[model samples]
Target chain A: MHELSIVFHIIKTIEQVGEENKLEHVNSVTLEVGEVSAVIDEYLGDCWKWAADRSELLKGARLVIEKLPAVTMCETCERTYATVQYGRICPYCGSERTYLLSGREINIKEIEVG
Target chain B: MQNNSIDVICAAAGSGRMEHFMKEVKILEIKKSVFEDNDREADALRGELHEKGIFLLNLMSSPGSGKTTTLLRTIEALKDRLKIAVMEADIDSDVDAHAIAGAGVKAIQLHTGGMCHLDAGMTRQGLEGLEAAEADLVVLENVGNLVCPAEFDTGAVKNAMILSVPEGHDKPLKYPLMFEVCDVVLINKIDVLPYFDFDLEKCREYVRMRNPEAEIIPICAKTGEGIDAWADWILREVAAWKADK
Candidate 1:
């Protein structure tokens, strides 16, 4: 699954940070995931639990996810709307010139250490 | 007096243990994107390729979409003019590599070990395995999937994907990211277009909607039709890439 690869990348990034900070143990990791990032939170958590425990630093570390809502900006109408509610087309002008404003992010915000 | 002082210090430590524990817990701020590392690696690899004057094309598509056949045709067409090599990536198979080697070119197979896609690091390893430094062009035949491969950059100079006639025209709409990332979309298996209800114009429109800059080339790899244009595209790209530096 793609989630497994994502988890592997996360571990690699965290390991680099751990080395730089000389961290003994990571208590938790907080992530800011977007609403339309195509990553299922449950699957990510499951994959994280299975893969994280294999690493010494991330073993038993809690995963906290913060969801960012999807918004689309209409180029023609210059109006923004919820992407989940109306996709691609602007509701005000029915124009197809629209692009995503956000909601595709997968970032590591912070880590709790002890 | 020493024994009374030791007792007082022990009582203080016992009462302050909770506060010390609380103080030990610290939050470290690290605001970073998950793809930042891979993207950096990919950019570095691109720079290295540019200095070496080698053009790398990352080819992606759904399974059974004629990716290997198109590669074979491409190699056959450009083998004499350019020093070309290939890296075939799959879950578990050396069949494609064997086929390419049989075509009289340097070829290597990369197993993803059950992973669906290859990242920049994996691509670099494959390039090293193929000893592709001497080659003018190296094509990375990425794992046959439309979704995961698009999300990961393989350090290629350009990305291309094949959408056969049988796969229908709505694929761009269904897999928007795949179409968006591709520099060119090869519409393969046009020989069977008469039998299927596939509309070429409609497909072009959909792809344009997703990516107006994407070049569409219709071809039938089996019949060797429209391959010259594809080969010419590569020729121009390789020349441009080498000349830009």
Candidate 2:
């Protein structure tokens, strides 16, 4: 699955951060996953566990995932609504002039080192 | 660093006394997007392709949605008029590449090794293999997936998606992200429109609801209907894309 590739990418990033920070070992990694993002959190965790364990800097590191809500901005109404509840049309003005504001993110929010 | 070492030593020495040792947990806020690296790479690739005046189109669709057929039709329409090449991506097998090659143009097969989607790096690799700089138009026929490919920008100048008539008109409702990111939506397989209960107007409405600016084109890839319009749209887009650069 692509989750493995993403896991590898994360590990590579974390390793670079570790090198720059002179981090001997990482305790945990926190990631913010958006509701509309294609990545599956459970699969990501599984992939991370499998890959992170092999890396010396990330050995036994716990992966934490925080879900971010999907939001959409209505251009016609100048208001925002939960994208998960409403597809694309603005619920307030019944307008199709809406764009996704956020929730497609897959951000590495924080890193805990020991 | 010295203070941490002393604290660790104290904690080990005062193992029996919990109150004697105080440890502080340190956390660094990264606040960095996981897609940051990919996005940066995609932007760089886009710049490189733009410098070469190559208009890259990322074509996505579900499996069996006539992506190859539509590509074949597109090649037939535009190959003689302009230089065209294809980077066909699939989980495995080069059947699509062979088909494109049969159409009498350069075709490079990208086997993802079971990856459902092609990332920016993968696309760059495919472009390198396809020798895209020599061609005026390079079409990246991404892996036949509606979900994963929608999330990744493949450094394409324009993103186009095909929704076949047999797939029903309600697909945008289920897969909103795919329709939302598309610059153009191609409604393919109109020749079989009479047999299926698929409504063209409803499909267009759904696409419009998700993406108001997306150009919707209905065509039958098998019969070559509405291909000239598609080719003209491409020509205009290519000119606009190059001119803007």
Candidate 3:
């Protein structure tokens, strides 16, 4: 799964930040995931466990994930709906042409350090 | 501030510590994208493509969507008329590279090593190795996936989506963004139309319902049916882009 590589990036980023700030360890890492993003949450958590276990900087650190739903803006009723459905359409207007307002995110929000 | 102030004097000192127990905690606010570096890298790559006048097309679909076949056919048809190059993304196999190498143009095979999609960072690396020296048309055949590839932008001018008849007409509805974001939609396997229940009109309507301006071209790459039309569409696009510059 691509989660492994993405997890590696997160690990590398944390280490870089740690090294720059002269921190000994990271307590927790948080991520905001977009609904359409191809990340499997459980897989990412499992992968993080394996990766964090071997490294001194991330030993036993908590992995937190927040999901962001794909926002479908209705052209007819002008309403927005949160949906994970692929080919997401506005629930109110039933418009297939709605713009996705948010979601599809993959980013580290913040890391708690000691 | 009293460190040992018990809320209820009736309870014991340790048991009356409701102030510490029910204390509200505030989270540190730091807004940042986990994919910030990736998106920034992709945006830079897009800038490069725009400057070079390279008509980059990130072709996507399932494993047997005729992705390599379509490129081969395109090379055979367009190499003489225009300069063409290919960047093929795969996990481990170089069979597609070997096949495309001798086809009479510069082709680079990028081994993703189990990566499902090609992000801008990897694509930028791949382009560094790719021969854009004697090339004008650049095509990136992504790792044949419908989900992951849709999330990342590889700095391509257009996302050429290959929808084979065997994949069913509902594919457009299922993979909506893939169909919606595509500049051109090529429906392959039209030669098998008689044996299958794939409705051409229904698919056109389906794509239009999502994106009205998207161009749909039905083709049978195996038999060369509608191949000229497909080639013509690509060439015309390249010409229009070149003229704009």
Candidate 4:
């Protein structure tokens, strides 16, 4: 539901970033969305095209989404790995505890403009 | 000689003006987020909330998701143990405050003047003149919505949501963030299960799919069924949070 609105914000930001760099038009935008950031990736992509097509500077801009896996740092081994299954336990060390490192990320990494 | 020189200068000026007007290039570069400026304010609000040891809870749900009822019950249950208060955000109504006050809790209402969602600055302002300054827990009953409220981060310590059984089990699938960002989930309206086709296990399953670690507590506000257990769970969380802070 918020996909279209978020896409609009992303497009607007891209335009500003492009203009700041003196670019004529945005060709592509790279957004790194964490697997656990509560954002629907497929829906985001769908909303991206519809929103980008309306803008003058960002019209037809490609939305490239980089899906990030949920990772946690092990308390015992101090190693980080994808949290494939449920539970905050470390995958390798089998420790009952671990800190969540990076999974909830919604970021605009870079933009390519002409 | 002076008249000839003046005539020549006027002709040159006219030609130059014409050249400047004909087919000049367009700059064609200006794009910016209408709300990018709001993001920084939102971040600052989050930091401020954390620094003050305020465990902020932004409660979101459908209109009839028992938000106010649950809050009234919560305030009644947890008042003595925790320094708690309520901030109600609405388009234009003071009814929520009246209801919260009826339950014997400090209440403040913020009218958005028709804005759909509550922003960080509005939240900070809403907190003013309230008795929650030394509060351990502060709850914000967000504008009754499943969409716009999910987008704005009111610098809350935790975002919680309610999904009444009558609203259906497919809600998590439809409104994922309301379930995803939630640190706790209260599956409200369980008393109507006999009259409706709502499933407790199924509802939990749906939420778990979106967010595995989400704690789900099923309760019926109208009948006071299972409210104590749910309330106990929340109070424990608040106690734990205060200790951590």
Candidate 5:
């Protein structure tokens, strides 16, 4: 699954950060995932638990996720609306000239170490 | 050593877990994109390709969308003018690679070991395996999937996808990211358009709604119709990529 690859990327990034900061152990990691980023949180958590336990520094580390809502901007109306509520078509203007403003983000916000 | 000595003293003084209580936990603010590493790797690979004067095209599409057939046609059209190579990525099997090699070009197969997509690192490895420096154009036939491949950049100079007539025109709306990332959309199997009730204009409109800048080329890889236009697009892209530097 793509979530496994994402977990691998997270581990790799965390390992790089650990080396740079000389971290002995990671306590937790917080992620900022957009609402429509296509990443399933449960699958990500499952993949993280399986993969993190294999890394000595990240063993037993907790995974925290913070969701960012999806927003779309209508070019015709110049108004922003919830992407999930009203998809490609603008609800206000009934126009197809709309683009996503946000909601596809998958970022690592922070990490806790002890 | 100081903390260890304090812990020993605390233990000797019968202070229950004073050292553990005194240990400080710190939060490191690393506001980084999850794809930051991959994106950096992809950019570096692009720079390397540019210096080598090589054009890498990342081709993506669904299974049975005629990627291999279209690639064969493309090679037949451009093989005489340009040195072309291919890296076929799949979860298993070397069938695509074999087909490409049979076409009298350098071809290598990359097995992703069940991964659905190829990242920048995997692409570099494939390029190395193919000894791609000898070739002017190296096409990475990415795993035949629309979703995961769009999320990962394969370090290619350009990205293209094949949407067959049977797949419906709403694919751009369904897989918006795939269409948005592609530089060109090849609408293949146009020979059967009359039988399929596939409206080319409607498809173009949908793709434009997703990506206004994408160039759509309608072709039938089987009949070799409109292949010259596709070949022309490649020729122009390769020339532009080489000339820019």
Candidate 6:
């Protein structure tokens, strides 16, 4: 449901970049989505195909996605661990004084123009 | 450049052949988070709200979690002491907004059209619609969804969530991110403790395991069991917010 809104945001950003670079056509876009971002790539792709086809610059544009691992930092032991594996608790020290360091991102990494 | 070298080699070994082999292609590096714009807007809104001395509390919970009932009860408790307003966000109707207005406080409904969550920009617009500048407290009753609402910040001074006893005590394990970001977690519907097998202590432990700093308050809005404690928490938060200003 929210994927369409996200696609619109992505298209607006690419259009701004295109305008700044004086480009006419966008061939593809590369996105770096975190493992824990809760944004499903399949839905994003479907939404992109529906929305991007309507834009003049993004017609037939390809969408590529890259995944980033989620990591958590333990303040007690000052160690980093996989968030998906152990959640909020630190595996090394059994400490709940931990916070997420990464893996909640939805980034546009690159844009290819032809 | 590599293509140009390949073209040069092709020309050297060619048997009298000419072709158009050069094409202009640009690979622009745009390493930007899709949420960067929203996060920046949230920070700016936070700064603006802080300057205006308005304590914004973002309330989130799952559907049928008695968020409206809790809000009404809260208003009855704190309306005499503080000026409160509500911005109710929903995907479709204004039912919650109407309920809030019936409570005799300023209320505004934000129709997200179809969006599942409320972003900072949407919250700012809602605040403007409610004329929240004059109110001492603005409660943004965010759209009822545990997963999506926790993903976005709406420039609120504090984030609070409600979990009813019927919703099960294992909510923290299922929705860890929500518990992780909340400053306070209100375990509501404790009056039904005898009916359901909801373990209050186990629930508290689950919430604490995810967020050690979060304050868990047990309440039954239907009977006003823990309304005083909840109201006190709000007053303390409002005072601390003012002190920071």
lDDT of 6 at B238: 89
Error of 1 at A61 (Å): 0.5
Candidate 1 vs candidate 6, DockQ winner: 1
Please list the C-alpha lDDT of all candidates, in the order they appear. 0.89, 0.85, 0.78, 0.72, 0.90, 0.86
Superposed model 2: Cα runs more than 4 Å off: A72-99, B1-24
> Could you give candidate 5's per-residue lDDT for residues B139-176 as a string of tens digits?
99999998999999889999999999999988998999
Highest TM-score: which candidate? 5
Q: What's model 5's overall lDDT?
A: 0.90
Runs with alpha carbons beyond 4 Å of true place in candidate 3: A12-24, A52-59, A82-100, B1-28, B240-245
Q: Tens-digit lDDT track for model 4 on A3-53?
A: 665675676566555554455776777787767765688888888878788
Per-model TM-score, in order, reads 0.91, 0.88, 0.83, 0.62, 0.93, 0.86
lDDT per residue, candidate 2, A9-77, as tens digits? 788777877775567887898999889888888899898989999999999999999999999999898
lDDT of 3: 0.78
Model 1: pairs clashing at backbone N, Cα or C within 3 Å: none
Task: Write candidate 1's Cα lDDT for B107-224 as tens digits.
Answer: 9999999999999999999999999889999999999999889988889999999999999998998888899999999999999999998999999999998889999999999999
lDDT of 6 by residue, B1-245 (tens): 12453231111112112223336655666777776667778899989988988999999999999899999999999999999999999999999999999999999999999888898989999998888778889999999899888878888989999999999999997888899989999999999999998999999988987888999999999999998999999999988887898
User: Going through the candidates in order, what is chain B's TM-score?
Assistant: 0.90, 0.89, 0.85, 0.82, 0.90, 0.89
Q: How would you order the candidates by DockQ, starting with the best?
A: 5, 1, 6, 2, 3, 4
Q: List the residue pairs that clash in candidate 5.
A: none
Which scores higher on lDDT, 1 or 4?
1
TM-score winner between 1 and 6, please give it. 1
lDDT of candidate 2 over B1-245, digit per residue (tens): 12333232111112211112225445656667776677788899999988999999999999999999999999999988789999999888998999999999999999999888888999999998887677889999998888888877889989999999999999987788899889999999999999999988988888887888899999889999988999999999988878988
- Assign candidate 2 its CAPRI class: acceptable
lDDT tens readout by residue for model 5, A15-104:
887775567998999999999997899999999999999999999999999999999999998999999988889998899988889999
Q: Which ten residues in a row have the lowest lDDT in candidate 5 chain B?
A: B8-17
| Runs in model 4 lying further than 4 Å from the true structure | A1-114, B1-39, B129-131
Docking class of 6: acceptable
Model 4: pairs clashing at backbone N, Cα or C within 3 Å: A16-B31
